[model samples]
Target: MCRLFALTSKDPVSPMEAIKALDVMKEGHDGSGVGLLLRDLGGPFEEMKDAPILSGIFSEEGIRKLDLFMMDQGFMTKYKMSIKVPKQTLEGTPKRGLYLLRAYEYPDSWNVDTLDEKELATRLMMTRLKIREMGEEKKDMIVFSFWPDTIMLKELGDPMQIARHLGLDRKDLKARTIMAQGRQNTNYAINLYACHPFFIKGYSTMTNGENTAFIPIRDFLSSRDFPGYMGYQSDSEVFAHILHYTMSGLDLGLDAYKHVITPLQDRDIENHPDATFLKHLKKSCRQLIIDGPNCVIGTLPDNTLFMAQDRKKLRPGVVGGRPGMFAFSSEVCGLDAVIPDRDKSKDIQPMHLDTAIVGPDRQEVKICRQTEPLTLPL
Candidate 1:
């Protein structure tokens, strides 16, 4: 199993904190790869929240093509943070040329005053796909996300070692919310794209169990005709897309997400307050239901962090911390490494019917159980 660690705090913290937490749970995961998704960013990115940031790796020729393409697309480079890769990288780390986090201004042709959020998101996703396709042949570019206040860094090797290789230990690189994974490489080959903490638009998620229902779920999502749902390099990628679809596509609430992905059985649904609605959801979303052993941890567009388990509840995960800060990990030791001062009695270990959520305010965690009333706004 891969080790999943996510933290959301009122103040920005370095990604090294999460990396160190993953190091504590190093025994659970093989040193195959590491993926980090930082959102609600800090440092220089904190001042440029409006600008969409592109995070990925690029070769020498790829950077040239990216610059020209951005120019043609009318996006101006507002700010760029390029990692200075050391001459000698840790063994097993891929030989990457350029690691970049570039924030771009709105296109010259667009009316910034009238542009809506959805339109902006669509344009950014399309541009990212175009760049991805351009580099497919030579493998010059490997773009993870193109969204505001978000930056993703991924590489192959031990999590802590890769962190140093990418200069993630620096003070300037920080975010209020971070989702990280230490991959085990049990199912898929050791490919960078197959790394965890997948992102689409503004939603991001990472999982810690084999997705037995990946193919059908992928097929259902692909049929939706969404460009951002195209990459299925890893089975866990579907978790992020499923989130985008349920909340953004269907206009559903967070509680509805657990219902759609892992709906209650008929016996349980019959006792639900919204049984009629739940029945319809189960029937309509049958293809999306996940059969697992999986534990999913994710962050919404608003920076709300959540963790949910499959029916089997085979994967281990826990959330613990005080108000203004919280950490979710696959093991208690991981949380102890980050926020040891917190009360252990309050730590949450969500079961098959629970979804532990911490809103963007960094307030207390609210556990929403499947048996409870679905009171969240729809």
Candidate 2:
């Protein structure tokens, strides 16, 4: 099994806090790998908010090839940050090429004003696919997350050890939101793509349990003809893609996620207060449902956060925080590690029927409890 931790703050906080929380639950994961995703970034990235940040690791040769590809695409790097994570700093970690975070402007003809969010997002995904395929061919370069407001870093080692290696232990690489997973390899080879906190466009997710429904969900997503939906090295990646599909493709509301993944029984829906729409929603998206023992913590476009547990609630999870901030984690101890001083009286371990949503607005935490039209803020 793996462990998951996510921290959403009204202000910038380091990824170290979330990684350290994973350390608190060290026994729960084997720690063969670690995946970190930071969005709603602060620090230097905040200044480059309009630029798309391309994040990946590349060997010297791969970097040379990558530069050529970017130039061919008519993209120009406005600024680049080369992260030199020395091998010596990571005692037991596997060595790889330097990790890079570079911001780029759109192709010469395609100005930012003319390209909408989806267009730029599509371009980033296609570029990422090129990088991923290149890496697959020779095994040196792998691109992780590429969107307007996020950066992803993944590695094979203990979370603490990886953080120490990157010197994140001593620095605050700030982001308003951050997620880290202590990955326990279950199905595929220990490939980097198999790590949690998977992203496509602006949506991202990290899971703490197995996805028994992966095959059907993957098939459904791939059928969408969206390039980003094609890759599924990790079953949990579907969780992120599905969220994107629900939000961008179907134009469904946030509550649609719970409905699609763990829809209510027809009988319950028939009796639901909003039966007309509830019935239509379940019938329309039945193919996207998930069967599990899985719990997922994720974010949508606007720094909106959510946590969902399967109908069985097989994996543990909790949501708690004070005003203007919140945490949705696989365990409560993680919340304690991050928001120890927050009001404990409001802590919630949502039942299987609940979907804990933190925002379209970040002022309060909202829980959609079992199809009741009412939403109560915690």
Candidate 3:
């Protein structure tokens, strides 16, 4: 098991808020690693939302190589900010190099391709793929995310220790939206890439349970011509990819997320008010179905946050907080740590049939459930 915590608010807050919350659930995680994502960025990143931030780590030699590579690829750095830790001691992971967070103006073509955003996103994914693959043998550099309006950090350590290492003290690292995960390694080795709270161009997800449907999901994604779908260090990573595939790849609305991940039974579908469409979804994209004892918390490109539970409802999740802030958690204790005095009546623990959505500004909160069957013309 792992601990997943995310908080989105109208105002900027330090990463410590998430760190402190995760610390409360340390029993569920082994302090193996930490992945931090900040969006609706405040502090230094506040004014630079238009530029794509390229965040990852590098070695001394790797830095030079990275400069050459980006220059060759038509990337020019617009602004840069980074934190480098020396002699890190955290769990069983060994320290190898320096980490950085830098923002760049998108390659001119991509920046101007506003009409074809997915094509641009695919370019970004392919670039990230090159960095991860080519940098492997030399272990020169690793880039995590390259997107406008957000920054990501991942490292092997206790969440608190990693927080300190990040210098979260000043508002420099503040953001209105922050997500964190305390690692509980159940799959691949505790490599940085395998860490929870995975991110793609604009989509991100962190899970607390294993995805039993991994192989089929991987196969479906791999068959796509895109380069981002090949890596599967964590089965839950596919959750984010699947989210990307469902929403961006197919231009489907958010409701399709449920149809693809956890569909209704034949009887349940026949009985559903939206049966016709649901049945069409089941028949057309059956490859996306997820077999789970899994519960997921994630964000889409628009920063619309959501939470979902599998059919078995095996993993625990609770969503509750004050008006300006909504917290998504894997347990009630995590929510209590975020908004301890939250109204008990307003607390939401979505069942298998429900998906909880909180808007970008906390303006509204609603539970999206399966629609009732409707009578329609044949």
Measured with C-alpha atoms, the lDDT of residue 279 in candidate 3 is: 87
Ordered by lDDT, highest first, the candidates read 1, 2, 3
Error of 1 at 282 (Å): 0.5
The CA-based lDDT of model 1 is what?
0.92
Task: List the lowest-lDDT window of 10 residues for candidate 2.
Answer: 369-378
Error of 3 at 327 (Å): 0.5
Best by lDDT: 1
Considering TM-score, which of the candidate structures 2 and 3 is the better prediction for this target? 2
Candidate 2 Cα misplacement greater than 4 A, ranges: 89-92, 170-172, 373-378
TM-score of decoy 1: 0.98
Clashing residue pairs, candidate 1? none
Supply candidate 2's per-residue lDDT for 342: 83
Pitting candidate 1 against candidate 2, the one with the higher lDDT is: 1
lDDT of 1 by residue, 267-325 (tens): 99999999988898899889999988899999999999999999999999999999999
lDDT (Cα, tens digit) per residue for candidate 2, span 233-307: 888889898888887887777677777788889888887787777777777777788888888889887888888
